[model samples]
Target: MTHTRRDVFLGLGAVGLLGACANGVGGRGGATIDARVDATLAQLYRDYPATRQLADKSAGLLVMPLVTEAGLGFGGGGGNGALRIGGATVDYYNMVKASGGLQIGVQQYSHVLFFMTDDALQTFRRSGGFAAGAGIAYATPQKGEALAAETTTSLAPVIAVIFGQSGLRVGATLEGVKYTRIIP
Candidate 1:
């Protein structure tokens, strides 16, 4: 099989489409991922109710706008999420530089993570400034979102806001992707 640049993108596109088949939840195996998203969001609201107040705080920092990329390379699953710190929603494709292995297949998932504290929130404020060290639990889920619980590198004044992603599977380290705000 001669895989040229075109073939590479074609494979990526196919995987991406399969992942996009669902709205990030309630599709095929999406039930699990969606359920996780909902539980996490509810817990986030309870844990960091203040984030609602700080939603307008994030700015200048990396804005990772929600993006849907179709790829058939290694992993095939589309999930959308937004993380707001200092009034700016910092999430999207280019914002979070991803660098890790991948898994490809037809799947759908959704999730949102809030940095529940001031220091942790600030860490991400810098352009590509998430001091994620080795074994620094990158992605986790609630119920199935992430049993490890929220990892607060430091206790800074902050809150977490998660919504509509109750069931999803996030690799220990899914790289190069981020969550950007969506202004309606």
Candidate 2:
């Protein structure tokens, strides 16, 4: 058998798409997504008490309970989640990512975005797809310590907290995530 570079790329793309879909990107409607959101929030607040304040102050929240990513040279990932406004599920969203760089390995992680202003939440909801930007502040947790919302996070309209990572990936960063609203 002879496989060209294009053939390999096509095969990888198909496998990545299938892997994303199989992760239940929009599988069971809002129920499963909301459940995961609730559990994720509970765990987050319990583990990082400092984040509860951010949640309380934020106008909305987008919680992606689990996103699985894998790659040898190219990589992709997807996950289902819920957006909460006023602490209630207002919409469902799916996150997808793709990247090509010096990367390899598989990983799973949870991420939550706190929309600190109504304007920010509205902009995200109205967009066809929202991508995390430089303005977004990240509250990355460290070992044996609660992540505190920095002054920069308070100034930014959107704050992202990524935690509960389990994988063998060398470095993890949500640099190219594209989030879109989903019916499920």
Candidate 3:
């Protein structure tokens, strides 16, 4: 199949629109992001109490209040979040993802990354852009279900919990998601 220049521009435009749907995109800076993070954490703890145990043990937590994703053939997602340590927001970040495949729909969800070790947290902070990879452990617990932080999970450098998903998108994964520190 032959592609035209218009097709390329249209595809790029769609991806840009999808990325803009992310929460806190044009919000009131750090304060707004922090507020959302607080609420998201509260809801997570309420829905899955066992996560609190993980939170308590974590060296730091990156709470992405809401991420919006959309795709037809190519897809992209974006969200703003805050990194909290000792229950206080220390820095803000932006999470972005780009992918291509057979996909069609839009979805919004919240996710949290728990830094189980100080070294992991430091590495993330120092890196120009940290990308989620195979090394990270993912735990998706159904509502009211317990998140078992077994020996293996507890020992993992980073643990991710995704929840409060709503929309038509079939599945959510952190693969290829890149997180960068942002002033907001």
* TM-score winner: 3
Whole-model lDDT for model 3 versus the true structure?
0.83
C-alpha lDDT values of all predictions: 0.37, 0.79, 0.83
Query: Which candidate leads in lDDT?
Result: 3
Task: At residue 184, give the lDDT of candidate 2.
Answer: 64
State the lDDT of candidate 3 residue by residue for 1-184, as single tens digits.
Answer: 3445654555466678966563564557888898899899999999998888888888999999988877655668888999999999998999988765555678889999999999999999999999998778888789978886555355589999999989996544323689999885
Ranking by TM-score: 3, 2, 1
TM-score, candidate 1, is 0.39
Each candidate: RMSD: 9.2, 3.7, 2.8
Worst lDDT run of 10 residues, candidate 1, spans 58-67
* Residue 71, model 2, lDDT: 61
Per-residue CA lDDT of model 2 for 1-184, tens digit only, reads 3445864585387446646465444457677778789999999998888888888888999999998877645667778898999888988888877755545677888999999889999999999999887778887786457666656356689999899999886544334889998886
State candidate 3's TM-score.
Answer: 0.88
